[model samples]
Target: MTTEASGTSPLNHPEPAARTLRYSAFTHDPAGGNPAGVVLDASRLDEAAMLALAAEVGYSETAFVTGADEQARRFRVRYFSPLAEVAFCGHATVALAVALAERLGPGEIVLDTPAGEIPVATRVDDEGAVLATLTSVPTRSRPASDTELDATLAALGWSRGDLDPELPPHVAFGGNDHLVLAAASRTRLAKLDYDFEGLAEVMRRYGWTTVHLVWRESPELFHARDPFPVGGVVEDPATGAAAAAFGGYLRAVGLVTSPARISVRQGEDMGRPGDLLIDVDPHGTRTRVTGGAVPIAEAGGPRRS
Candidate 1:
């Protein structure tokens, strides 16, 4: 493994650091999707250093891979945010899958992540990016108590009336926990405002990764946003973990029944539009999330000298 100053490495410093990571998760379009930072080799960076680097890069989450030789395909992985390390991250996984596909040619890759072992299948499409699908760990869902739900609603300045009747309130876990809240109207989903510090405090106390705010646009599609105050971010335009958790939520609550596939269109409201696919099985333990990613730019490409 090799290390360079933040943004100075061959992969990161062609012009801006964003070019180094080759993924636009949740969408096939390279220009219209969630961007994630993926480092194929992270052995050179320690935990604190990785966290600092992630903070500097400022993506919602960055994936670091360690303990894998060049000859091997598997990697030990971890994810970090600006403030701390997390148990799992979906977008980063998609980004890593694309990066691996770029290097090893399109194929299936297995990652030993902090949350669990995730298997990803990758292939390139006419859109000119490597598409990857990650099967998440077994999912679990539980209804939030009235008190907990009240505190959550208060943090978002939302009332019980704003919630969708079809999807009830629940805390869903794919890898980490998310409070799933469905908005009754598309207008409510568009108008996103929340208590920053207040919500952060509550989220930290409850060990929540994000608040999944969604409005179903159609039976197979939805508009989504995530409040990640716990990670010190106000919102995430595209969230893979929340998407996986939502699939579990839908199945557990009978919203989608069993053996359903759905697409989530996110980041549109934020202008960095991305799309994600979710596959749920009535009997299978894992849920699959799929999307495409591209190298933001070429390594050693032209730069402003």
Candidate 2:
């Protein structure tokens, strides 16, 4: 099936089924987190078509819910970036969880993603908005080669001196692979200008999803940014995948002991600031990423064919 939604098209056609796609994984305020396009019901969309729709949505990622089973809790979920389909997306998962909570009532929901089964727990906050926590897949970390590290640094226009001596280079995988590079200074993190195509080539070669550029502000807090050229987006405002990977990065390197929580402030550079909360547990292999989301106003326009 082919489906489309147009937010800005002069030409007109039959009214497309409109679902308010919000930028979730945000905090209480809508503008304070990563933006995600949420399509609550996407049974009318096909694989190719969903990819196109996600591209048109122009966010880091877009989530489509195909259907829900009898219990009204289990759903088949798919994620698409601007460039292609992704196995999973954490922020989008949070957005979907909140959306589902509103529709199905506050509780837990099982999302069957291509990567694996994701269980999202949702609850109403003090202000009565839905907040969600998603348990990620088993996370693992591996050392990054010297050559790979040098090349990645070069692509980002940084030298070895700019790297934080405490946190060395490591490639971590939660739901996806991310190359974690800690910045020596917040100044370095604020000034981000990377070779998009060059880095994309390197990432594709290494099967990396995003380059997790981060600065350790404190023991329990960090500032982060993610370059996602592979997904046809320059940056990801809020990235759950990177957060999960970071949890593993901290653990493998002994930066953070088991059973800890970290706050990641992202999207501040983009003017759409957002927050991501990551829970690290030593008992289990999986990392938990949590956040909140809100819906955006629907834009008026014709359907895109």
TM per candidate: 0.88, 0.90
How many steric overlaps does candidate 2 have? 4
**Which structure among the candidates has the greatest lDDT?**
2
lDDT of each: 0.79, 0.81
- lDDT for each residue of candidate 1 in 1-305, tens digit (9 for 90 to 100): 22333544333344343223545567665566666667765666789988887776676778887655334456678898778899999998988888777766888788888899888898888866678899999999999889878998898899999999888889999999999999999999888888888888888888889999889988889888888877757777688999989988888888776588898988877777888889988776568999877666532211111
Residue lDDT tens for model 2, 112-137: 89889888899998988888989888
Q: Which parts of model 1 have CA positions greater than 4 angstroms off?
A: 1-22, 28-31, 69-72, 298-305
Report the lDDT of model 2 for residue 24.
51
Candidate 2 has a TM-score of 0.90
Q: After superposition, how far is residue 296 of candidate 1 from its true place, in Å?
A: 2.2
